[model samples]
Target: MNFFQFFVWGSWLISLGGYMGNQLGFSGLQIGSVYSTMGIASVFMPGLLGIVADRWVNAERVFALAHFIAAGALIAAAGMTDFASFYTYMLVHSLFYMPTLALSNSVCYNVLTRRNFDVVKTFPPIRVWGTVGFIVAMWAVDLLGWTKSANQLYLAAGAGLFLGCYAFTVPPSPPYLDETRKKSLMSSLGLDAFVLFRKKNIALFFVFSLLLGAALQITNAFGGPFLDDFKTKYPDSFGVKHPNLLLSISQISETLFILLIPFFLTRFGIRNVILFSIVAWVLRFALFGLGNPDDRLYLLILSMIIYGMAFDFFNISGSLYVEKMAEPTIRSSAQGLFMIMTNGFGAIIGSYGSGWVVDHFTDSGGVRDWPNIWFTFAGYALALAVLFLLVFRDRRIEDIKR
Candidate 1:
């Protein structure tokens, strides 16, 4: 279930930018606008549908239905030639697809708990397969020469269809009809979690989450196309020839770094964990600015490797911090708020903002200044880190009043 769940996303997530820009000649803003669909959908879909799964429908069934709809949307998107049509189809797909990520977890947890497995211990091993699936999909697409073609979408659609059918066979997970708590669209939007803003530390943490979230999208939106550009300069280079495979290293690094998060959080405290993550972000972009497909390829590799630290530290650590700080009654809502700040608002900022940055650096002849663009991103991250260091204060969770 986990494997095919991510298999659907891995088939297209990293390579779509390359396809849109290289094959369809989309401008950076247009491409970014399209990628932002995930963010736009993410803002409301997951929470809204989660309410349905919790109160009205079986989660597995909802999960299955979402995948089936997303599959059709992917098929529609694959046939689109213009940005408007492609964006519309992809937006429809994102609306149904983004929520399934949470639904899959819900289903897994429900089944695992019913079978008497220790969720904390058993779920990680099972979940790691999702990353493995993602890496495998990246390699598959790269090797099949589908990176710049619409075929990746077709592949994803096939996977989505299969997963949708398979979801029904999972353990029966009925809605919790006894859940008496009122769940509304506004609460689902994380507006209830806005009360956390009264606390200075939590407020500051979320503000930085928004900023760093912006940094996360810069690489994802452009990294593949950046490597693809190298074909003009070093057609025979491995990075140029297999950008997806090279990019897969970041996912591989993610799996490794997630294992190390426990030690890092215990040793350094959450503040320093976040600091390390911000510093790593600075390197992630700077290394990209300095590296290439040839002599400086090592820099690119190093960047990919550090991505594990840059991404996992803040995201996992931030979630853990939120869990520790929020009262038990509001814990789930707190997590939802964290996702909203990062993936929702932050994604919108990152997608549109990075697209503008990319266009600003590109010449009228349509040649992008890749290094300068990366350097500019690095500078943005650096500023965030500096401001964060000055404004945020760390307090022990035990010391804070609930």
Candidate 2:
């Protein structure tokens, strides 16, 4: 169920741009709403809902209720024709929606800890299936011809509803907090992670995390649409007919690549793995800029292939690095801080920036100026790579391994 949440996102996340830009004639900023909505909601909803789960409610119940609420909002969104109304609706829905990412993780942690599972040994393997779920959902959406159509929400709505109900079936996870403790709402909700921002190195990492995050969403918000644009540039292209599934190849790559991480992190260390991700991002964008939806598609396909390294290398290794760096007492809080930077602020910056850039550079017809857009994004990533290499001080995984 947790895995499929990402699948719901992957189904339309990349393809929505094509629908908005090519099919519906919407503006780029309008297209950006998809990314921005997730970011905005991550800012508050996860914390508030998490607090409720911590003190008053069963975690599974909270999960089910959130999905149920999101399902109704998504179904209502399915009927929206205007962008503003649709945007507002999705935003509201996202408030209920984005927190589930953490809630699901929390639920899993509770279960695993209760069962005395070794999370370091067992969890990563299980979590890899979530990537599988994401890929499957993407393939399904693409194969079904549902990209950008209102019908895509039906897919997500069904998933949300099922997950909501199925959550109740999971072993109950009641709030663990003591009711008599004099806890402030911030502490209750786990917002105490904010204190990490006062430190210099951590703050720098988070700042760059937002910048890298900008690059991350660029492909997500644009890949399907960019590929689909090939149809217009050269008519009768495969992308026009098949954008969703082809973009799904990235998700497939994500699954295959995550398996390699343990070995890579052990051998190359966090800095090198992150370097691979940065370099991969540059390649990922540049390949799309050069490749076509037509015969030169090998390049396009290769770009999709590299997405695994570009996304997972940085994201997963970064997560592991946080685990290695933090004191045991504050380890969970450190993870929360990492998420706030990457998912919350980073996602917001990336979404709005990508939207503004795409919106401003493209003409009224929604045709993207591909090379310039991609190259500019690559440049931003290059800058982060350089800054991180210089400033963050490298520490080998072997040195950190317990």
Candidate 3:
């Protein structure tokens, strides 16, 4: 289930920029606008759906229905020639698909707790397979020469359709509502999870989540186009020809780093683990600024390797942190809030902001000042890391366990 869930995303998430720019001739701003659909949907859909799962419907059914609809949206998106039409389909797709992210985690947590499995210990290994699935989908697209074609959307659609069907086979996760009890509107809508913000530590953590989330989309939005630009500059380069395969190294590293989450969280606690991620983002962007495919290929590979830590340390561990801290009744809502902060508000900022930066550095001839653009991004990460270190307070894992 985790496998196909991410497989659908991997098919196009990284490579979509190159496809839109190279084939469809989308401007940088237009592409960013399209990607921001994920953010717009994420801001409300996850929380709203979390409420539905918590009070009204089964989570697995919601997951299945969302994917089934998303499959049709992807197929329709593939046939779109105009940006307006494509954006509309993708917007529809994002509305249904973004909610499923929180829903899937909710379903998994429900089943695991029911089976008496420790989530911190067991979920990472299972979730590692999602990265494996992402890698496989990336390789399939690369090997099949679909990176800059609409066929990638077809691949995603097929996977979505399959997962939609498979979702019904998962363990049942019924609503947690009590019929005898009368609930306030906020509680009924799952907005009660917002109360966590009243706590200083939780509030600070979410603020940093928003900051770090900005870094997440920068790479996903531009990495492929960055590598593919080499084809125009140095047509003989391996990086230019195999950009998808090259980018797959990040997913490969993600799989390894995911397995280390249990140890990192237990030993270093949430504060240090997240700090490591912030530091990694600093290196991730700086390396991109300094390296290229020819003589500096090693730096690029190292950058990709560090992506595992940059991504998994914060996102996966943060999800586990939410699972540990929130009450059982509101667990789904808390996870949705996490998604709202990271993928919702943060993604919107990153998408539009990065597009403006790229456009600013672009010349009249359409050549982008890639190194300077990357350096600007690196500076943003470095400043955020410093701010996080100073502002966020640490709480020990022992305290969390108690």
Number of backbone collisions per candidate:
0, 0, 0
Best by TM-score: 3
lDDT of 1 by residue, 118-190 (tens): 5444555577678788888989999999999899999999999999999989998776543333555544443
lDDT of 3 by residue, 1-402 (tens): 999999999999999988988889998888888888898888999988887787778989989999999999999999998999999999999999988888889999999999999888989998888898899999999999999999999999999999999999999998876653236766854576898888777888889988888888888988988988777667877778888898899999998999998888888888999999999999999999988887888999999999999999999988888878777777788889999999999999988888899899989988888899899999999999899888886766763453
In the range 1-402, model 2's lDDT, one tens digit per residue, is 657767666656777677666666667787776668877887667766766676678878988999999888888887887787778778877788877866776677667767987544455566687788787777787788878687777788888888888888888777655444235665654655566667665566667666677677778887867776666566777666777767777878887778888878778876678778988988888888788878888888898999989999887666666555554333445554565567777788888898888777788765679888887787877777887788877564653364
Q: After aligning candidate 2 to the native by TM-score, how far in Å is the CA of 142 from where it should be?
A: 1.8
Each prediction's TM-score versus the true structure: 0.89, 0.89, 0.98
Q: What is the lDDT of residue 338 in candidate 2?
A: 63
Worst 10 residues of 3 by lDDT: 180-189
What lDDT, from 0 to 1, does candidate 2 have?
0.73
Q: Top model by lDDT, which number?
A: 3
Residue 238's C-alpha lDDT in candidate 3? 73
lDDT (Cα) of model 1? 0.82
Candidate lDDT scores, in order, read 0.82, 0.73, 0.88
Residue 36, model 1: lDDT of 88
